[model samples]
Target: MTFSLRRMLYEDRYKLILAACQDIRRHREEVAKTVIASQLLDALDVDVPSDALLSHIVAESLLRRIDRNLLSGRNLYLQVEKRPQIDLFTLLQRAIPAVPQGYALANQYLVHAMRQSSTPTLLEIGIGKGLQVVALLRALARDPGKIERIRVIALDPNRTALTEGVAAIDEVRAELPFDIEIYPLVKLIEVCEDADYAHFEALAEGSLSINAAYTLHHTTGPDSDARTRLLRRLRALKPRVFTLVEPSSDHDTEHLTRRMHHCWQHFATVFDLVDRSDASPDEKFAIKEGFFGREVRDILGTSDAFRCERHETLESWLLRLKKSGFVPYPEIELDVDLPEYCRSSVSSGLVRLSYRSVPIIAVFAFAGEAG
Candidate 1:
């Protein structure tokens, strides 16, 4: 067979599987859905090393099928209260290095934003378990003379996350030479009102900084303007610097085929990194199934209204930040080590972390229009 013909055949198979999924979504013929499910399961039996992406798609489709039938006619994403899968999630994140690298890079600007102040306050959006905030506090503590006291206004929709994140931050407080105060807010960015911004502004004493790592994309709205509106509200708070880190994919799209393609391309790099990690096989399986697999399920399986993992491209984020009256805040390059296969680049005042040649995560800093 000619190479072109083989490529064409390969794409056709993927399209056929996707069409099967759409048919299941639209016309729920149990027999047809079962056949498609069986085909996907059989496809997973193939062990070609280069077919990892294809294998993951098949596996994800199977999970979505199970979710549809097993959830009593309700989408699982809507019904279940998601708890933090911390250990495996951290393992997967550490293995990839993109998340940690983004955290480190964002911390650089976050610390820089507060270096000159005697009293620094941070308004961290979606401060999940305070991982990044704890890291940022530690970085700030390195120069105890510059900063005497710090306050953190942590916001997250997950009550459990907010509670535990506050505890984690407090644990580090006793060890630091500076005084630490934390105010935890259990709220979503979409629903935060003017009172919330006023409260945040009132909390500031000297310098204020904002950091949203792997957050903000979760802000779902009735329309696309939800994120922009939230950013505008945040801009009004007038933090010295705002740093954001988000996945470099467009899974927020309503089109399933496009979402599937983007998810496959983006997660393939992530899963490949997990596969290469020195982690135990069971650990990797847990990370892939428990952490990343759930993300895949939410993206591909749930209804548009119920879906929460709304990721977008770096370009789209830049446009939204500009629309909300933000200008790029530059950072000094750090001398941090990365995995041999990973690469980092700084361009247009944005730092992009990539696996092989595909960009996976983007980190950038911006200031409000006045600043």
Candidate 2:
């Protein structure tokens, strides 16, 4: 056979092997285990079985490999190259009716923030897949003549994420009645960087308003100098308003406890609802053990890096803004209603879950000559 023919034959053989494996009784479970195991290996820079393995023994072995890889302390993203494309906006929209109370809280908070200025140029940090941006744009579409043109600059370090987000924004815009424009800023520009300051200043120099959301936590860590630097940079830009919405879990000594509780409560609920019971025992164990049990604990343990003092409480964040020479507005609270899968996990003891008896704070701060 010619080289091209041989290559085609090999490709066909691999596909046939995969198809054969799929015919097994526990095919779904097996596939899940293989995918997870392969991901773990990929993260570890270790070679794994690329050829199809049909035996249960092979599947069990792969699961063991995944457990070992996890024990080695690898990043989850490294292990799993492809994450499920979640339609976050659609999910949020569907969840609104079921959790109207929670939706009302978020809507009210967002409305109050928007009302702070007539033409706020919304800036979103960590614009993952552009879902939140799309939602914000949709909301803005309700009153196209609110005041003036809106500019959105989405910043992220990952080029792939930014590209995907931009594409998603374009896809969403095609379906919408409004013609809002979105700009993609791909540099991992820190709030503290001089270049960042210049870039932002140029964007906001003529714009009527400025705002940011859900992007502050990325700048936090044990390095107080870095944190201070970031704060100073943000203060310099002096955006008309800034809003931060983060996970409300405390990050002190109880970090692990909070994370475990959140994972068990939130993720476990999601798994029960979305995952199939017929999935391989290995796959089920992973969701229970690998993600909720291991991953959450690992992340919480690194609270110093992940925790934000400003995010700990809205009052504290508001106070910081005041101290920095910005007027603090009345803080609002927004609750993201958990999905049905997550709701199930909460009901079960799989995850520790709690709803703030009082309202959870989601504050906004205003700068410049506030109208």
Candidate 3:
């Protein structure tokens, strides 16, 4: 029966993972670390493996203090959903040496675009903590005298994160002179269709624009016709600019072996940053397990349509946008002289220019003559 075959395969993988853990005890080689990390990322993608599972994984895989310290936290899924611990991930993104430099990269684009328009309708997809956006609004407020007003439409499948984001924005409304109205809509962009966008026109007012920081990759596919459809809908809205912040790797593929390799390489760099950081042990573990670990699990454990963390590269992104009728801002080759801070970030290995050209976080102006 099919069930029997599935059970046999699962048992075989569990045995292999356990055996790999054993191998790590005897030899601390590059292969051993990769095996353990790959298996653990696999186990973590779907659900929290048992304490016994973690025990075996830790005993053989990590450094002494790190092994003991990593297990001291709650399950990866539960811990991140807590409103208070959300700050841990935020700190990792904005403060800790974050490679790809998502926090500041997106903020710069938003600030620059905001300055260009008197009343730009800023729409965001998957606004998690509302930290960077709030920072942006504050930066704009330094002008003080302009009666600035903009509408923010925060769309996310998780209403809880949206609620948290809205609450965070409300807390800062007093400090800024800008009048802003935030509308929270719950929808998965990948699955959403042309009909769903009927309301988008009404929501967008003034010089419409977008600020999507670390969220667009969740769309169901870099495959199927799904990605094309989604991009077309976005293009139809015709925002002044679409700012994207995403990882610069091929994590969205369905191939598990390739996925694990990409995951290991990407997270290794991230974990190194955590090790170098002044963040507390708990904070570091939270970023490692809750944020990065969840991304691995979501990418590997779920089918493409169901996965929460599907990501694509800049090349693929440009192609898809063009297919849907859009183009990268300025020209691909015409380099915008990034601020000295952005250039300096590359030395720390926190951010890098793609193709030795642009930052990992890029803003694409929709190439449409009208917004």
Selected candidate, larger TM-score, 1 vs 2: 1
Q: Can you tell me which runs of candidate 1 are displaced by over 4 Å?
A: 1-35, 42-84
Local accuracy of candidate 2 as per-residue lDDT tens digits, 1-371: 11221232124423332342343324454554444344232231112222221111122333442344433554433442322323332333332222223223333444455544444555566666766666655665664444344556777767887887788777766555444556678765463367666766776654423444445544554553454455455656665544444333322223332332332233333333223334444444333333333333343323344433223344445445555555443444434454333321111101122232211224244543343
Which regions in candidate 3 have their CA more than 4 angstroms from the true location? Answer: 1-88, 144-147, 193-196, 221-223, 301-306, 331-371
Quote the positional error of residue 294 for candidate 3 in Å.
2.6
Q: Is candidate 2 or candidate 3 better by lDDT?
A: 3
**TM-score to native of every candidate shown:** 0.84, 0.52, 0.67
Question: What overall lDDT, based on C-alpha atoms, would model 3 receive against the true structure?
Answer: 0.56
Best by lDDT: 1
Count of steric clashes across candidates, in order: 0, 8, 2
- The total of clashing pairs for model 1 equals 0
Task: Give residue 62's lDDT in candidate 2 (0 to 100).
Answer: 31
Q: Which ten residues in a row have the lowest lDDT in candidate 1?
A: 1-10
Instruction: Choose the strongest candidate by TM-score.
Output: 1
Ranking by lDDT: 1, 3, 2
Clashing pairs in 2: 29-280, 264-351, 265-351, 269-341, 269-342, 269-345, 270-341, 270-342
- lDDT (10s digit) by residue, model 1, range 106-217: 8888887787788889998888788888888888888654788898999998899899899999889867878888889999877988888888888886478888988888
